[model samples]
Target: MTPSNILSVEAYFDLICPWCLIGKRHLETAIDLLARERPDVTVQLEWRSYPLIPATPPDGIPYRDFYVARLGSPQAVAVRQAQVIAAAREAGLTLALDRIETFPNTMLAHRLVRFVRTQDGAAAAATLVDNLFTRYFMRGANIGDGHVLREALAECGIQSPLEQGASVQHDMDWLPPLNGPDDPPPRAGLGVPHFIFNGTHSVSGSRPPEALLEAMLRALARAKQIATRAVA
Candidate 1:
């Protein structure tokens, strides 16, 4: 397919969400599978912003309390968390549930991702996601902390823009315009980890690699049909 007819997917998510991380891993597997199946198909990925706890303080809150509050019943919450841990392990990811001390604001991390998107593209954003997940879920680091963020970014080969804030902004346009109360959310009527395929269809949550590949193929077909109709 031509570059114009290629499929594009924009994934909206936050680093704090375990399901989001699982979804990302599945998506990566799907991409690899698709590349092998259809060498002609080109997929463009864009990572968009979705903060799970926008109101979360910079210092963060204890994970146990957070889950108990959100899930209501302590027993049910434990069961659900166990499932998440197992799922993460199955996906070749280590999730240390007990070690997580706090859940912090992901706004700045999202901003950092947006910045990385401008400078190094989607791959960089993916790396940031992976790093943040590992840090928070496995290493039990406070992601909302600037020091931790800087360290993670450096590990991912992304220079800390905050250190040299002014120069970095000029070079990468890292500063995003503030969204007012009236401003709409990133994607219209879409939830966390929502994947918009080639501006045609939307897929939400963590889906199997087979499902993702099917959606990608459908998106590619849709693009071709649109191109043909335009010519006619």
Candidate 2:
């Protein structure tokens, strides 16, 4: 398939996951590199919903407890988090892991993303997700808080209360469930930052830039083929 015939790529992710932010940066860098190599290929990016730790309480869990419970020991958790931070840096993302105070439920954030999609489609959603990640992971802001989430949406040019209202109304229908009878079971119950490319290719975790670049290129090719067949 030719570059010109390639359609957009949809990325499913959540803001709270550190790996998701790293993966996002890698994908963006890959897209930039691809653009330089193949100037004619226009890849529109679409951000979809995939919440991590969806059943988290609204008030948020203590970061230390959460990490220790997941990683066994406080020291081990710190080491693991440090590894993620180093990886994020290598991916050109500055993550201030020390500043994160709370691990709030991301349901509201996901809902807000759905709301943005209605107004500006996927582009706005992408912007919002990027901002939220930067704010939460890099700057160590409380993304679980309604005020912070609202402000982040506003930064992306969305009206706060109105958008929130719309999101609340359509949250169940628009946003994908984390886990329930209605939710589609993830591929092997994958974690956050899981990416399904063109509904065929699956990539999980914070992959390197080169790997994501290859995935995107492959997804683009598959998309082009499907589009051409449809037209034919």
Candidate 3:
């Protein structure tokens, strides 16, 4: 397989978002399908940090109350959660939304991902990402807490002390600053759980595995075309 056969999938997500977890599941399934169908193609998955609710306090706030306030009422929150739950269920994942207490400030969590990626490698960082998501969404753990983050890091076989302070912020230097209230929205203005294929095709939101798979295939084709053009 040539370099052109490698498909890069960049996923922008926030750990606190249930949809990001569901999106991760879909992306995984899509990769599996691509592997089965295109044995010669290699998919490189990169997870980017996109904090959906950056304004949340460093210590975080009550999860239920946060949603209730944002969505207007308890009934509205329930309806929205139910919709997300149904989507997650379809993806073969379960989200314990009701059990979550803190909405959490995900800066530390995202920085931890970058730290693990730098020290251990992308694969280790991916494992840590999965662990963090599970801890928060499934186990209702507060990922914002340094203690919880350290535990999650240890679970991923990372024994080094958790990086903190100004250094943690520097870990995110590779990407642009998080969107501010006044800044124009991100690509497509679709927010977290956004997927970019080979930096060419982008799909926003938690789309189905099939749709993601299609995007991967299209990206691979475009890569091949570009490679051919270069040779010509």
Candidate 4:
């Protein structure tokens, strides 16, 4: 058995992305598997905000129409959504895309998550994340609505004073623009459901649980090597 070590993981996601929810499920499974295989290793996970389309209006646009236009036609949209549904099913998720009516601007939602993390904790924020995804995809709630967000926050037991606003206004202070020229390739054009292990190894897209577990092992091994070299 290896000596104890802590593995840090950062997950960048957008609330509106179905794959983000699916990827989150896989990551949880991977974490559980890692705990069984390497009891000596502890995982520290943090969720980061990455809005796919920041330009989306606060009120949002018609969800089905948005996809139809983006994917060229309703048939193409159907095909793409079908693929998403199949992938989600594999992760034990059932996404009701038909229930969704509006494609919301996720900026407010992400800001609220940060706020919750600050006021409560990571676990509380995580619960809010799950609630937000479920509300939008499963119940077809327009998450961009302040009322909707407040309802989710209440469900998470977050009693922050910001509850009245339903939106947190940190002004994107923590994160830099995704398209910054200084960023590297994948970082610049990174897709949602991206994960970084130990701040070095990265896995993009909604990969399988096995793949995530392998990445965690690799990150742990690298951390061990660095510690060994430091002692030497």
* TM-score for all models, in order of appearance: 0.87, 0.82, 0.88, 0.89
Residues 1-232, model 2: lDDT tens digits: 4643454566778787788888888888878888877677777677767776779987789877888898899899989988998888798777887888887788877777766776567777788888998898878887877668767877888654556464443334644444445324555565767666666576777787688778767877787787779889
**Candidate 1 off by > 4 Å:** 1-5, 165-174, 177-184
Worst 10 residues of 1 by lDDT: 175-184
lDDT of 2 at 83: 91
Q: What is the Cα root-mean-square deviation between model 4 and the actual structure?
A: 3.9
Best-performing candidate as measured by TM-score: 4
- Evaluated against the true structure, the overall lDDT of model 1 is 0.78
lDDT of each: 0.78, 0.74, 0.82, 0.83
Q: Please give the RMSD to the true structure for each candidate, in Å.
A: 3.9, 4.1, 4.4, 3.9
RMSD value for candidate 3: 4.4
- Judged by TM-score relative to the true structure, which candidate is superior, 1 or 2? 1
Error of 4 at 186 (Å): 9.4
For candidate 4, the TM-score is: 0.89
Model 2 poorest 10 in a row by lDDT: 175-184
Question: Could you say which candidate leads in lDDT?
Answer: 4
